[model samples]
Target: MAFRCQRDSYAREFTTSVVACCPAELQTDAGGKKEVLRGFHVVLEDTLLFPEGGGQPDDRGTINDIPVLRVTRRGAQADHFTQTPLSPGSQVQVQVDWERRFDHMQQHSGQHLITAVADHLFGLKTTSWELGRLRSIIELDSPSVTAEQVAAIEQSVNEKIRNRLPVTVRELSLDDPEVEQVRGRGLPDDHAGPIRVITIEGVDSNMCCGTHVSNLSDLQVIKILGTEKGKKNKTNLMFLAGNRVLKWMERSHGTEKALTTLLKCGAEEHVEAVKKLQNSIKLLQKEEPSLLQFHSLTSTWISCLFPLSRKEGDSEFMNIIANEIGSEETLLLLTVGDEKGAGLFLLSGPAEAVETLGPRVAEILEGKGAGKKGRFQGKATKMSRRAEVQALLQDYVSTQSAEE
Candidate 1:
C-alpha cells in the first residue's frame, strides 16, 4: 500500500478504496497505560495521512466527514482510526490535516538545515531529533555548544532560507553506493526498501522519510531558542521554525510589556527593578524575628507566643525559648506563629503539668505533638485564638491556689 503523501506532499484529500475496517482494540501507550478508544481502524489502499514515525507525530483529519483520531503505520500499510467504519471495496474521501502537515514540514526541514550547518561549520553531528508540540529539538553529538557557535549556525540556516534554495527529493536503493554520502546521521537497522533522499539544493542530502517543504523559502525563518544537556553528554538544541517563531516573538513581547507595567519601570530597567524588590523583601524578613515578645502568665507559668516569618526548625527555636523562660518546676508553653495563620506549639517545665496539661492543650488547639517526661511539641492552626492560651494558664493557677 503506497502512501499518497509520499508521492505528493500537497495532497489535501483523495478518494481511496478501503481495504479493511477492523474493530478497535485496547492500545497500550509508552507509559504502559491501556486505553480503549471507541473507533475502527480503517485500512485504505492508499493514505493521504502520514503515520506517527521518525520523531514526527501522526497527521489528523477526516475520512468521509468523520473525524480521524489517529493514523498508525504497520509494515507496508497505514491505518486510519475513526468512529465511522468505511465498508471494504467502497471509496471514501480521505483528507489530511493541511495546517498540521505543513507545520511539521516546516520544522522537519528546518531541522535538516540546522543539522547540516552544525556538522559543516563545527563538526557537530545530529544524533537525534524530535518534533515537539510547541518546539522542535535536535540532539548534537557534543558535550557543549557555545553561544557563538549557536549564533553562527542559526545565521547560516536563516541565510539558506532567505536564499530560497530548491529542496529536491530523490529515491535510492538501500544498497546503493550513494548511501555513504549521508552527512550527519545514520540509517535505522530495520529500515528497508528504497531510501528517500531529501536534498537541500547544494547544502545537504540525507535519507529522510519525513515530509519536507519543496523550497527553503517555505520555512520562512528559523530561530534557535536554547540548548540543554541531554543523555550521554549530548547537547539538545531547542528551536522553532516558520510561524512558531513568530508566535513565540508575540508572546515574548506581551510578557515583557506586562512585566514593565507591574514593576513600574521601563522595559530596559525590568531586571534591576526585580533585583531591588527581592533585596527589599529579604531585608524585611531579616527584621521580623526581632519582633518576638515574652509575657509572664502566672508565678509558675509563662507564655511566649510571637508572630514571625515561618522558617524550618521553628519547633526547636520555640523549645529553646521555653527553656529560657523558667526553671524545671515552672510550667512553660512557647508558640511561634506566622502571618498566614499557622502556628506550632512547644510545652516544657514541670513533669505533672506537662504530662497532664500538655495533651489537654493539644486537644483544645486541635493539634498533636510528642516529647519526653516534661516536654511536648506539635503544630496547630487558628493563630487568632492566641489569647485562650493565657486564660487556660490563669485558670490553672487559680484552681491550684483554691485547692491549697
Candidate 2:
C-alpha cells in the first residue's frame, strides 16, 4: 500500500500551524472598486483553514497579525485570503478562531447525527445540507415525514449528542474495502485522489469534505425548527444546535415575559386569558348595534345639555357612531376635548348611503378612508375648525340630492 501525505487532511486536528506568505494587490472588478490585495495567497501549504466548498462557508480569522478574510480551494490546493500583504518566504503564525471553528464543528457534527438517525429510523437519506448563521437546513430524499417521525429523529439525535460518540476522520482510496463497507453516501467516483470519510462510531460513515467536531457530546442539543415539502420526493428540515438553541430559548423566554406583563396574567394563565379576552371582544362586537341606542341617547343629551357647538374631533366620533347605529339621513355634530387637536367623523344615511357619500366626505375631512361595501369611514386629527367639516358634509349631502 502506498502512503500518501497526511499533512493536509490532518491539519484540522491541530490548533496552530505555519503558512506561506504571498503578495496581495488591489484590483477592480465588474461590480466597482474594492480593497483587493492585502495579504499573500498561499499556493500550497498545510493549514487548518477549511476553504469554502461543498455548500459550507469558509473559515475566517487572523494569521500572524494579518486578518485572514477567506479560505478557498483551487482544485486540490487551499488558498488563504488575507488583509495585509505578506513578504515572500516569510513564516507566518496562524491561529484559527476556535469559537467559530468549534461552532461549525458542532453544527456539522449535529448534521451527521440527525442525518444518520433519519436514515436509520425512516430510511430517508439527506440529499443536501447547509449550515446557516442561526440554523441549518437539510434536504431529505424522502417526500414527507410525519411530525412524529421528525420528533423521533430529533429525540434520537439529542440522545446521540448525550452519548458523546467519537467522530473519526479517515482517508482512504476509492477502491478500499473499508470504504466499501461504509453504508452511507459516497462521494463522486470519478474524482482522483484520496477520499475523506467522516465516521460516527456505531452510527454512520459518510463521505464528506467539511470539518467537524471530534465528539458528539460537543453538540449540546439539536432542535428541529420545522420541516417542509421540497421537490416531488424531498423534504427540507431546519434545525438549531448548541449556542443557537440557548439563544433561541432566551429570546422565547423574554417574549413570554413581555406577553405576560402586557396581558396582566401569569405565564401559566396567559393562554386561557387570551382565549377569554378574544371571546369577550367577539361578544361585545355582536352587542355593539344595541349599544348604539344608548350612545345616540347620550349624544342627544350631551348636545342638548352642553353646547350645540361641536369640535371637529367629537363631530367625527358622533358621525361614525351614528353610522354604526344603522342611521340614515341623520346629522351628527359634537365636539370634545380642547381646540388644539381633536378627532372627528361625519356620517349621513344608512351604512350604504354613508358609503355613497364617503368620497365626498373624505374630501371635506381632508383625510383618506375606506368603508365596508357602503359605509363612510374617515377621521380628522386636528379639530381647530369643526365648522369646516360640517360645511363640507352639508355640501356633499346637497350635491348627492341634486345628482339623484
Which candidate achieves the best TM-score against the true structure? 1
In candidate 2, stretches whose alpha carbon ends up further than 4 angstroms from where it belongs are: 1-40, 183-192, 273-404
lDDT of 1 by residue, 1-404 (tens): 23688767878999989899988853646578767777799898888999887778889899888898888887777888887878999988988889999999999999999999999999998999999999999999999999999999999999999999999877787678888876535656655557788899989998787788999999999999989998999999999999899999999999999998887789999998777666545544554445333233334243322323333336545544555444554556666665247688776766776777777767766677777778887877755555676577657756765766
State in Å the error of residue 112, model 2.
Answer: 0.7
Question: How does each model score on TM-score?
Answer: 0.69, 0.62
As a TM-score, model 2 comes out at: 0.62
State the C-alpha lDDT per candidate. 0.78, 0.66
The Cα error of candidate 1 at residue 174, in Å, is 2.8
The TM-score between candidate 1 and the true structure equals 0.69
lDDT by residue for model 2 (1-404), tens = 11111223223333333446566543535467564555567543456667765556777666666667777666666677765655545565666666677777778878888888998998988888899977899999987888999899999998888888888878788779888777555554434467778899899987777777778877888899989889878899999988888889999899899988877788898887677666545544654665656466656632211112333223333434444443444434334444566454444444555566566656654556566644455565555655665676567556665676
